[model samples]
Target: MALVASLCNRVIVMYAGRIVEQGPTRAIFKNPQHPYTWSLLRSMPRMDEVGKERLVSIRGVPPDLGKLPTGCKFHPRCRFKVDRCLTEEPPLGEVDPEQLARCWVLMKNVSNPEMQS
Candidate 1:
C-alpha cells in the first residue's frame, strides 16, 4: 500500500477474483467506502502510534479460491455482513466519476457512519 500510494496514480482493490473498489489513489485512501477497504486500513500500523505498538489485523481466514462461497465472497469475513450479502452478489457501482465499489450496503449508502454496518 505504501508503495502503491507513493507510485500509483490509481488503485484497484480486489477480493476473491472480484474487484471491490477502484479509484484515484488519493480518493480511495482518503475516503474508502467499502467494508474491505475499511478493514484493510484498520489493520495497518498507524503512523501516529508510538514505538512498540501492536499492529491491527483483519479477522477471519481468506476464502478458498477454487471452492468459493456464494454471492458476495467477502460476506463471511466482513463485519458488515447482511442478509443480502449472503445471497446477492453486488455489482461494481460508481461512487464518483473515478471511484467504484461493490457492496450492497455501501451501494445503498456509502456515507453510512458505521463502516461495520
Candidate 2:
C-alpha cells in the first residue's frame, strides 16, 4: 500500500475533496501518530482486547467529495475531536520520526513506547 501511494510524489488525501492530510507514505504510515490514526488503530479489533467481536469502525459514512464541508472535514466522525475541531481545519503536520498527522491531538511531540525499532 505504501509503495502504491508513494509513486505519485504526492498523496491526495481527500476528505470531501479537501486535502486533510498529505505527505510521503512512509512518513505518514510509520509515524502517523495522528489522533485519527490512533483512533483508527484502536477501532481495529485486536485478539487481546477481550470481548472484541470485530474491528471498530469510524462512526459515519464518508462525506460526498463533491459536497465537501467547510472547516475540519473529520469533525463529525472523529472520536478525538475537540471544540476546535468543529470550527477550524487542522493542517497536516509532521509529528516527528517522519510522521504526518492531520489531527490536533496526535500532532504534538511524543514518543510511542510500543513501536519497535
Candidate 3:
C-alpha cells in the first residue's frame, strides 16, 4: 500500500473479483468512499504509529470465489452495511469529483464512530 501510494497516481480497489472503488490515490487514501476501502485502510499498519497503534482487522471471513454472495459481495463483512446491501448490488457511482465507489451506504453519509477523529 505504501508502495502504491508512492508510485501510483490513481488506484482501483477490488473485492470479490469486482471493482469496488477507483480514484486518485491521494483522494482515495485521504477519504475512502467504500466501507471495504475504509476497513482496508484501517487494517494496514502505519509505520509512524508503530507499536503505539493496534492494527484493526476486518470482521468475518472472505467469501468463497466459486459461490459469492448475492447483492453486494462485501455486505456480509462490511460494518456499514444497510438492508439494501443484502439484496441489491450497488453501482459504481461517483462519491466525489474524481472518486467512484460501489456501496449502498457510502462512508460520507454514514456516521462511523471509529472515523470520528
Tens digits of lDDT, candidate 1, 1-111 = 788899999999998889999999998888887778867876777667857665556678999999899889999888777898998899998888999999887734644
lDDT of 1 at 69: 90
State candidate 2's TM-score.
0.57
What are the per-residue Cα lDDT tens digits for candidate 2 across 68-90? Answer: 55667877776556688777787
Global local distance difference test of model 2: 0.58
- True-vs-predicted CA distance for residue 67, candidate 1, Å: 1.2
TM-score of 3: 0.93
Best candidate according to TM-score: 3
Clashes of each: 0, 1, 0
- Residues 1-117, candidate 3: write the lDDT tens digits: 999999999999999999999999999999999989998998999989999978888999999999999999999898788799999999999988899999988888987548643
Location of the lowest summed lDDT over 10 successive residues in candidate 1? 107-116
Question: What are the root-mean-square deviations of the candidates from the true structure over C-alphas?
Answer: 2.9, 6.4, 2.1
Q: What is the TM-score (0 to 1) of candidate 1? A: 0.85
Question: Which sequence of candidate numbers ranks them by lDDT, best first?
Answer: 3, 1, 2
